[model samples]
Every structure is written in C-alpha cells, then in structure tokens.
Target: MPQPTGPATAPRAPATASSPPSAPPPFPPQSGPPPQEALAPRAPVPPAVSEATRLLCVGVHHDRAFREAVLDELYVHEERFPAPSVGIDAGRVLSHAVRARNHEVGWAGGIVGLWLLGLIVSGGLLALALLGSVGLVVARWIRGSGSADTGVGLVRRAVAFYVRWLSRLYLVYLFFAVVLAALFLGGGTFSGGSGFGPGLSDPLGFARLAAFLTLLVLAGIVACVALRRGQFARVVSEELSPSRFPHAQSDPAETTAGPRLSHLRTRLRAEQHQPLVMYEEDWPFRGFGTPFHTWSLAIELRPRGEAAPVPLDNGEILRRIVPLVEALRVPSPRKDPAAAAAVIDRLRELRLDECVFLPADGLEWRNGAPYAPDAFAAHRAAALEEGGEARRHFLRIRVGGWDEELVVTVFVRVHTQGGMLMAEFAPHVLTPVRRGYRLAEREARRHRALSWPGHIAWALVHTPSSFGDSVRTLGGWLWGELRRAFAGYAGAPAEGPSAAVRELGTDEDLSLFQEMDLDRYLKTIQDRVAGGVRTALREAGWATDEFDQKIIHVANGGVYIDSAKDSAIGIGNDNKISHTPGGKGGGKK
Candidate 1:
C-alpha cells in the first residue's frame, strides 16, 4: 500500500566508476499507468492476412498453371470411379445352339418320313440308325487328334472349304441337267417317240412321267441351293431356344471378387453432394476413314468482379472468329514439290475452279438464311426451351486449295446469362480421290448384288466371309450417313465423298488415292486451324482451355478418353503428344 502511493517507481541506481552515467529517466518512465501505446487498446491489429484470395484469383485467362491445375482436378475426379465391364460369349453359345437345332430338325424330318412310309417299327429303327450315323460323323469331325494340330486341322478345314464350293458347283450342274432334259424330252416328243420310258407303248403316260421327273429335279435343285447358302444356318443361329442354351455361366473368381453394387451405391452416395461437370467431346468434321487431327479450345466466362460482360450476339462472335479462320492456311507446298504438283494436276483434271484448292488464303462467309419463327417454335416444341434469352447464328466458310476444298461451318449461340457464348467451329475438308466416281459405281453395283436374295444365298453358302464383310461395310456406311445428318444439323459440315469428285474420278484413280497417306496432309491443315483459333481467343482477352478436347475416331465410332493417363488431354495432330517444339499439342490449352 505504501509503495502504491508513489506508483511503484523504480529506485535510482548509484553511478559506477567504470560505467558512464545513465540519462535521466523520462517523466512517465516505468511507473504509474502503462504507456499510451501499451494501454490504449493497441490499435486493433489487422487480422492475419491470407494468400487464398491471391491463389484463387489466378484465373485461367492468362495463367497456364491454373489451366493445368483445373484439368488435373477434372481428370482425377473422373478416374476415381471404375467403369463397368460387359462380357459376352456370343460365338461359343451361338455355335452350340445351331448344332443342337440342326439335330432337332433332322430328328423331326426322320419322324415325318417314317409316318409317311407307314412302317412304324422298322422305319423308326432306320431313322434311329440314320441319326446315330450322322452323330458319329459329327463326333469324328470334332474329335481329330490333337497331335495333328496343324496338319489334320488344315485338311479338315480344306474339306469344309471344298464342300462349300462343291455345293455352289452343284447349282451349275442342276442348271445343265434341266437344259438337257428339256432338249431331249421336247425333241423326242415332237419326233413321236416316248420321251423317257418304254418306246411308244403309252406315249402320253411316258411324257407325263418325264414332265413329273423334271419338276421333281427342279425342286430338288432349288432346295439344294437354299441349303448350301447357309440360310438354314443363319435362321438356326438366330432363333436359338433359351431353354436349350441358357446364358453363359459366370466365372467363380469374378463372382467372388468383382465390385459389389453396394460399394458403388456407397461411393455414389458419398459423391452426390459434390459438384460434377459432364459433357461429351465430338470428333471434328472429317470424311470416313480420314484421320481425326483437330483439337478445340473451350472457354467459360462468368461475371467479373461486380460487373457483367456485355452480352455478345452471333454476328459479334462471327466477326471475332473470322480472322482466326483466315489465319489457318494450309502449309506451303514448297516443302514437297512433287506431292504438290501431283495434287495440282489431279485438281486440274477434275476441272475444279482455281479458288477451290487447298492452302486457301481466306474463307468466303455465307450467312445461312434464318429459319421462320414458326419453324423454330415447332422444333422447340418437343424439347425444353432455354430459359435465358438466346439466339443462334450460322456462318459457312468455304476455303479451297491444294486439290481440296474445306467447308467450315461456325455455329455461335449466345446467351444473356453471364454473357455466355458458345462457338462451335466445324471444318470439313473434301479431297479428290483419283477414281472416286468409279469406286462409288463399283460399290453401288456390289451393294445391289448383295441385296438380291439369290446372291445373298450364294454368298452365305459358298463365301460366308465375303457375305459378312459386305454386310459390315454397308451397315457402316448407313451408320456414318446417319451420324453425318445429325451432326450437320448441329452445325457440323456434312461428310462423305464429294459429289463433284465422285462424278468425275475413275476407279483406278480412287484406288490410288485410297492408298495415299492423306492423313499427313489433313493433319497439317488441322493443326494450323486449331492454333489460329487459340491465338485469336487469347489475344481477345478470352481464356482458352481444352478440357473438352477429347480424342475420338469418327470412323471407329465414339470418343476414347483414357482416364489413367489422361490421353485425351494433350492429343495433337498425330492423335498424341508432339515432342517437337512448335508442334501441335492439344491446341495449347
């Protein structure tokens, strides 16, 4: 209490001989209340600053690192879940079913024959013996010694081959037999001699017998041809009885070790609350069998700060992208003078306009006519209409050079919400085939022949391989056409052999062109176009990200994105990453 009266001031120390005297203490030194700096609620210190905002603000607009980070996140999330596997033993099951059905048919035929003959017991035994004999033959065919793996198998295969061919040859034999019978019988009848029986004893009866035998032979010939053609085999293969051939038994190992539905359900439930982005990447417009070398860059824009970007229209998007289109010229021909000259000569032969060549300087834009509002309304009737104000604009760019013509259709759809704009650049290049027209004509003829019942039958019997190949080719063509129609409606250029080239080229020319490595030339053009578009967007303050640049083979059907390696992320002109500097690599993000 006594010390508190003097505010606990420290006692002054005596000056030492070895030390200099200390300066006089300040009036408020070390006593009484604490100094103002200490006692005044020291100006509230600013809360500890964080770097989170800085990192987040590193937008993809100009930051390569940020773009890569975003892509990594997307790929990592996609790979987290495993894909389902589908297993089918179609070949094995179908083969067994066909054999069983054939046995059943044979048994049925034997029973019918016994009934017709009215010899129940004897005929039944004969039918059983016949069935046993056929089974024995089939067993022998299937039980060749494993020791003669190559030799015996080869001989058996050869026998099967010859048997099929012999069946077709028999058709020719039947035709000759019918002709000979007609000549001999008709000529003999006219000459007043019994055609094929005791001479002139009952001429009318003999003629009737000859006619009946001729009709019977013809029916047998038709039956033989149908049987040889594998029509029976096809039908048997398709209409298998489920009771006779149940689904393949599941592998015990798989049944025990495979992921359970519960696991998937739990995983899905855990992720349900998280955000997800789902979208498909389409193949660039290219002809069937042509290499897909194009890449695309997609940019997403949202309101910046507190201000929204001005909403763009179709016209504005076109104006912005046209310069990019012009910049994507084909590589100069000086690098390969010989190839260039050949291409030029081919184009000249086709009588294409000088402007309709590859390596073109610029495109000629054509604004497609707008659809009637009524038409638009009708189209939208079946689908959910976009709630935001929206407008679609179509622009077609025709650029030609280097024995090729490229049609690029740009579809720009603008939405007022967050000023969202979608620009789809679809470029299609049409190159002349040496004899495309002739090849097409040949294909048309082949297609017609295959469509005929007789030819199909012959093929099924004598050349199952050829029949299968033809069906696949025709089916593929039809599928490609359907895909083109749908994509074209969505602003992609139509694909296929060019009408002009198909009309003018010869078959030999087409064959030669088909053998050429058109992929390289097409790849070059694709790289340039993609690069130009990327550069244009970057310069316009727009961020470009190819998170959507998925790898797809149009000819093969569907997109292929490998989650393990993220292969689709960096695909380029070669459908893979380029090691060379300045080489195309996924359009530079």
Candidate 2:
C-alpha cells in the first residue's frame, strides 16, 4: 500500500546519545519603537515545527523503515541546531507554519468540493453563479482587509489559500461533466412511456443532445487544463513565500508542487546508495506443511551506474529455474486413491518416486520381486518375456508420516532398454488421495536439480524414513566442515562465519537442500561410488564386461546410480582394490 503524506502537527523528538549546546539568543530589539510600530507585528512566532511536521512537507511516500530513517535524520538536524531563547527559532517556526498552511489548503479544497457538489445539482446554474460571485467577493475582502498593519503576511497566505480551493473547483467541474455524460449516455430509454429509444422521433432532439455532449466534453477538458496550470502556479508561489519550510525539492516536471518534494527525492537518492541488503521472499518451503519455494536474491547499493543489474550466483539462479523438468517432477492433479497409485507406479518406472512403496512380495527382493540369479538360465526358459520399456508393474501406495496405509489399487508397467526405462502408471478412477499424492510429488521436485549425469539417467526416489535420516546426518557433517573451513578464512566476522554452517546444519526443511547446491555435491559423491562399484562388477563374470550400464532410482531431484545386481558375476579380472559397503570406517573385503 502507498504511504500517506501530509503535515504532522506533533513529531516525536529524536533520541540522541548526547545533547548539543544551547541555542543562541534572539536578535536585540530595534532602537526606536516609534512610528506606532511600522505596520503590525507578525503573529507571535508561528508554532515550532515538530519532527513530524518537518517530514510532512516532503510529500514523499515512505514505508515504515523509510519513515523511521527520515525521522532520525530530522532529529539529528534539531540536535545539531536547537532553538535559541532570544529572537524565536525562525527555521523551526517557519517549518511549522509552512506545514500548517499546507494542511489548511488541503482542508479548504475539500470544503469547496463538498459545497459545489451539494448545491450545484439542486440550485443548478444559479448555485454555481452564486458561489463564484461569493468567492470573488471574499477574495476581494481578504486582499483589501488585511492591511500592512496587522503584520500577519496574511495577504500572501490568503492568496495561497484562495488558489488552493480555486484549483479544486476546476477539478470538481471535470468530475461533474464526466458524471453528466455517463448519465446522458447510459439512460438511453428516456422514460417508461417512451415507445422507442431516446434516439428516435424528433431529429432536432438528437442534434441538441449531441451538441450538449460535445460541450460537456470540451468543458471537462478546459477544467482539467485549468486545474493543472493553477495547481502548478500555487505550488510555485507557496515555495517562493519567505515563510515556507525546508522539505524535499519538487520534481523538475512537477510545476504544480513545491521544492518540498524535491528535497524528499534527494534524501531517497542518497539513501539508495548506502548499502546492499538481502531479503527473503518468505521462509523456505516446509515439508507436508504450507508449501513454499526458496530462491536467493542479491541487491547492490551504490550501483556503479544507474542501470547496472545486480549480479546473482549460479546456485541462486538455478534455485528459481530447475523445477520445470517432468523427469524431476511428480505426477499432479490426481483425484482419488486409485489415481494416486497409478501416478506412483508410473513414477517408479520413470524412477520417479511419487510416494513411498513397500514390496508386497518377499522382503529379500527389491519392490516385491527377487532378482534372477542367471540371465542365461532365464533366457533358456524364456520365462521373462521382453516387454515395452514403458510398461510398469509395481505396488503403489501413498507415503505418510513414518507409516503406510493401503489406499488404492493399480499395476504399473516398466520396460528397460539401453539403461533407460519408459514407464506409465494408470488407475481405474480418481480420488482425493490421488490429489494429495500429486501435491506431495510436486513439492518434492519443485527445486530438483538434475544437471548431474546420474540425474539424467534415472529418477531419484526416497522413502521418508531414509530421507529424514540422510538429511539429519549429512547436514551435521556438512555444516561441521563449513564451520571448520570458515574459521581460517580471513576478514571474517569475529563471531565467525556461521550463516553457512548454521543454514546447512539442522535444516530439516528439505526445500533448503534443493535450493542450495548441496544436492549436486552429494550426487557427485554418489556418482563416484557408483563408478567404483561398476568397475568391481565388471571384474565378476555375471554381467557384461562393459562398464556402460547405469543404475536407476527415484531420488530427490531425480538421478541415476548403476545397478550392481545384473553385473555382479561378470568380472573375470583379478587386479583390484579391496573395498567394503561402508566407507571411512570399514575394512577391505
């Protein structure tokens, strides 16, 4: 929302660490009083300008932070130059009067608009004529009545006041014209008794209506022009008035306003150069809670030039762009439990884990089916007939909080060729569970980064239990490393570089991991492991001698890992390094 602007009568005093010295005394009285005091004295010093009153003159819109900053600046000025006891504080008094006068002008314009609207329709032209004449008479009275005596520069103020309202009247005229035109055009059927539309019958009536419409349009244009011209003139005159306060400078193009606006622009321009600040659109998406997306932004202060674009890091850019891949995304718009199963099954074939799945068959096998021990034996039996890569056959279920429940029924088909698979999952019907599954899938992949080779080969799928555990353990280690690293980086804050460490560790919210480059690093590690595993499998004679096959899985931000099951017995070489399933703490096999 735009900020409000106007005169502030009571501005809060600024808090200063230390108060300044007292103000100087006022000017000494002139020698001879005499001449019955040439003309009357100006109104006993105009009210002092409060901090708020000074700000009102700027007329610039300000957000909460901006407003506070401005107030602080104002307080600094006052502290540096306090009002003296002698000849009133001229600057303070003038600023106060200027703001007050501006406020009065605003009120006067409102009053004139009200009067014109309330009386114009009922009294017609007579009312306008009366009001105009009355206004002229008052103008004359104020000009002639306020003599050089009363000492109030009241005449200049009066003139300013008059023009302020006069401009408003022109505005009202423009409004009235628009309303009249709308009514004339919209009220097409004259009255209930009229047989045809108002355009029929007497041709002269139509001519008169056309001419009246044209006149109204022309009058509106003239009123608008006059308003613009008169407003500018008033603003210029107000600014020139010796009593005016120091506020912002007016826009160069805005002849209608005073320098107060200009001052405001100057201040804003100065502030924009102060420093660079980082802001988050919102908290990163929380799993299974209110869904949100995370992205990083950087803003630079004191820009080298007027048009320089802020530079963004690579990870930050990807944070915003990686969600478009279907391979990396989940099934969506599901309706029922059955639909959810279909989606889950299809996801499995594509290696996209839409939801958690537990094997319905024996626990020793993967996805409820044990791997065949010998390809040659199976081939001779021809028991496993080849099928299209897209066919999927997997038990599908929705994953819940550390639990599972049977909701829908579906058989997913999968076909594998050239180390890639095509799969599709379909259900008999749609249900709400399907919708929930779709949403979950989408949330999981919203920021999935699939730039790695493994990502291109297979989908990365995970069960809730394993995912939570991996996140917790990996986060701890990664953060610990970062903190240890930053401890030696120079020019760092005394408290140490902890934002990176803190953010990486203990962030259960998976969205953070996606938005960051941590996943890519982890994938790199997984890729190395898979490569080493494949080399070992090639040594065994059970699989192809070539190390080209890639493993597939549904991973957060889908990816691939070569399968060891099909190649375990293919290796025939003896030169190799001993290895164990676990790394860093395990012994060689």
Q: Number of clashes in every candidate structure?
A: 10, 54
Model 1 TM-score on a 0 to 1 scale: 0.29
Per-model lDDT: 0.29, 0.28
> How many times do residue backbones clash in model 2?
54
lDDT of 2 by residue, 1-589 (tens): 1112221122335545564545333332211112323122211112122222222222211111222222222221221111111111223323322343343344334434433443433224324334443454444445663345555667655684685467447435744664464345433333544644444234433433443444443343334333432343343335422234323233222233357534533332232211111111121110111111111111211222345434422222222222222122233555564453333221121111112111112222111122233532443223122442221122222111000111112222233334332332222101111122223233324323334443322221111012122233344434434644564422221110101100111112223322222234223323432343333333322242222332322123253222211111111123122221111111111
**What tens digits encode model 1's per-residue C-alpha lDDT throughout 403-480?**
121111122222223444443333322322223222333343354445457654654343212222223334443454
- Candidate 1: Cα lDDT at 415: 26
Residue 558, candidate 2: how far off, in angstroms?
Answer: 8.0
- TM-scores for all candidates: the values are 0.29, 0.16
Find the candidate with the highest TM-score and give its number: 1
